[model samples]
Target: MKKSDFRYDLPTELIAQHPLAARSASRLLLLPPAPAPLEDRAVRDLPALLAPGDLLVFNDTRVIPARLFGRKATGGRVEVLVERVLDGNEARAQLGVSKPPAAGSELVLDDGTRVAVLGREGEFYRLRFESDEPLEKLLKRIGRMPLPPYMTREPDAADAERYQTVFARAPGAVAAPTAGLHFDEALLAALRARGVEFGHITLHVGAGTFQPMRAEEFKDHVMHSEWLNVGASLCERIRAAKARGGRVVAVGTTVVRALESSFRDGEVRPFAGDTRLFLFPGKRIRSVDALVTNFHLPESTLLMLVSAFAGYERVMAAYAHAVRERYRFFSYGDAMLVFPEREGGTDATAHDSRLH
Candidate 1:
């Protein structure tokens, strides 16, 4: 499909700058099965909307403080956003500078730490931290939260906690699974009490999650790879849920990608690797039955993925309705609950389970 197919007008004012005082206070837009009247509700109302046997597959990948500011040896200012940590003291990063540094040049951080530029790998610069400390520890000490570019402000102390989900445990992602951020401990307990089963997947969201497509034909766009680990246990639980007639709801697009990547030939299995799976129109969603996601940018891969899950026209119409209703947009924005289209449907029941 053409990238323009996903384009829609969103008032700049609707772009949320900061999260609400309470995460569960955000509004929820329900895009039920096609032809069903859409409902407007709050995030706290999710428990009542979902069935008792529903399984929510959550992305537990934790966001890392990847934004770093430093200066070159020649006194040139430079900024670094770690795309993916390579090892204990190394990473692939996007470097922003007035003048790009050559290989072998070193950046001296404001904290007095030095990072040696190894070389360029694709669009990212290969960097080696000149410290005995682990990369995660160094980042925690000096790096700032890598907030989305649209937020128009530097990270504050409050962002350190509010930007993360309560279930976040695996520490690798540069971005949080925004949908999961809406579920606080109270909401989680409520869902658990209501008998909603929970499964965990890890997809370390990279800086690439924010990259815009340069191609007009969306299929020509090469997706950026992100690390993911979907265990056997979760797959087994999902299979069990399916056998019992429960729905598998992905908490974020990342979880959907991870789960679907592990599913092949009608079997969901364990997976641990990088995936560049791009879910757009015409692609079949084999496992997930429903989705809980934040409103995405216009003409974005995220929008296309949701469009594929639901129908393209219906998803776009819902987006228009969201704009007309003055709903928030992007990360730190309100949430959306989407059910698949009925016509070009995806039925999880037909797929037999090999997740043992």
Candidate 2:
């Protein structure tokens, strides 16, 4: 499909600049399996929208403080956003500077730590830290949170906590799996009490997630790679859920990508590697039944994935309704509970069975 097919008109004011005071307080837009009316609800109502025995797969990859400011040995200022940590003291990063630094160039960070440029890797620069301390530890001391470009304000104290999900553990991501951000301890506990099962997969979101597609056609677009780990245990949990006639609900697009990447031979398998899986209209999503995700950017790959899972026209209409209702957009925004499109008309029986 053409990239323009996914475009939508969103007001500048609708892009969420800050997170809501409470995680579970954000609004939820329910897009039932098409040919139905979109319902406006709150994040707290998530437990009720799901049925017992459902498996909610979450991306537990934690966001790291990846943004850093430094100066070249020649005294030119440069900004660094670490894309991925390669080792204890080495990382691949995107540099913002007046001119691209040559290989072997040295940079002095604001904190006085030095980093040596190893070389370039596509759009990223590989650098090795001169400090005896690990790169991750150094980032904890001086790096700032990497907020989305849409937010004009600098990262503050609240962002340190609010930008991360409560269940975040494995730290590597420069961006959060935002759909997981809506669940607090209370809501998780509520879901557990309602007999829902939980599973986790790790997909460290890269800064490339925000990169715009320059290609007009989807076939010409090359997706950025992200590392993911889908364990055998989680695969078994998904199978058990399916066996029990329960839905496999993905918490975010990241989780959806991970699960789908791990799917092989009609079942999910253990996988630990980088994936460049791109989901767009016409691709069958066999790994997940329902999805919980935040509003995405216009003409973005994320939006195309949503349009693929639900019907393209239906998703566009729902997005229009969200705009009319003034639903918040992007990272720190509201969410949606979306079910996959069925072969026939709407699966009202399955929809009603879960909600009622």
Candidate 3:
């Protein structure tokens, strides 16, 4: 299919520039599997919508302040968005300049730290910073938040407080698991009180997510690899939950990708490595029975993922409904709870075929 098929006219006025006063206060659009219809609710009502034995899988990959503004040794302006922390003083980053920085070139950061381009790894460049502190400690003190492009503003004090999920722990991701942003401490407590079980996984989101689809055929579009890990303990929990006839609810598209990528044979197995798995229409989902996520950009990979979870027609209808009801869109906007519509025969296309 052509990329144009995914394009929709998203009004600029509906884009949310800032977060709501309360995280869980956002509206929720519920789209059940096919043979059923769509339902609209509030995020605060999540506890009542879920069953006691369902497995709620969350991405605990925390967002780090990865954006660094600096100038090259030649006095040229440069911006670096750290993709991953490889080692103590080494990391991979996307350096923005007229030409990519060559090896051995030095750039001065906003905090007066200097980083020398050490090497190149595919689309990303390796940089070795002059610091004795661990990458996390250095970034927390020096780096600015890597807010999404639509914000049109620099990361400030508020972003430090609002951009991360309440359960963030393993710090590595460059971007936030935005759908998880809606769950506050109280909301999580309510879910726990209802006996909803929780498990954790990690998938450090890459810069590819923010990249717009430039190809016509969706299959031609490629995704960058991101490191992920699904532990054995989590696998045991998921199997137990499934055996008990409970649904596996993925908190975001990242969790869905990680879980589905790790599945082997008839059971979900633990996996540790990089995955470039991409989900779109006609793909079969072996994992993630339900999804909780924010509305995504038109013609973006994230939109395709949601469309894959719910049928394309259902997603389009829900988006139309959201717009008519004046629901917010994107990172700082409202969320959707979509249950996969696979009640009919499976689609002919395997999940990997749509990855391209």
Q: What is the per-residue lDDT of model 2 for residues 1-356, given as tens digits with 9 covering 90 to 100? A: 79999889999999999999899999999998656678999999988889899999999999999999999999999999999998759999999999999999999999899999999988889999899988888999999999998899999999999999999999999999999999999999999999999999999999999999889998899899999999989999998988888888999999989988998988789999999999998988888888999999999999999888888988999899999999999999999999877742211236655774
- In model 2, which range of ten residues has the least summed lDDT? 343-352
Model 3 compared with the native: what TM-score? 0.93
Give Cα distance to truth, residue 255, candidate 1, Å: 0.6
Which candidate, 1 or 3, would have the higher TM-score against the true structure? 1
Candidate 1 — which pairs collide?
none
52 in model 1: Cα distance from truth in Å? 1.3
Worst 10 residues of 3 by lDDT: 347-356
In model 3, which runs have C-alpha deviations exceeding 4 angstroms? 344-356
lDDT to native, each model: 0.89, 0.91, 0.84
Which ranges in model 1 have alpha carbons more than 4 Å from their true place?
348-356
Model 3: per-residue Cα lDDT over 214-311, one tens digit each? 88886787787899999999999998987776778899999988988998886789999999888888877777778899988888888888888787
Which RMSD does model 2 reach against the true structure?
1.7
Mark the 10 consecutive residues where model 1 has the least summed lDDT: 347-356
lDDT of 2 at 236: 91
Please state every model's RMSD to the true fold in angstroms.
3.6, 1.7, 4.8
lDDT of 1: 0.89
Off by over 4 Å in 2: 343-349
- Candidate 2 CA-lDDT value: 0.91
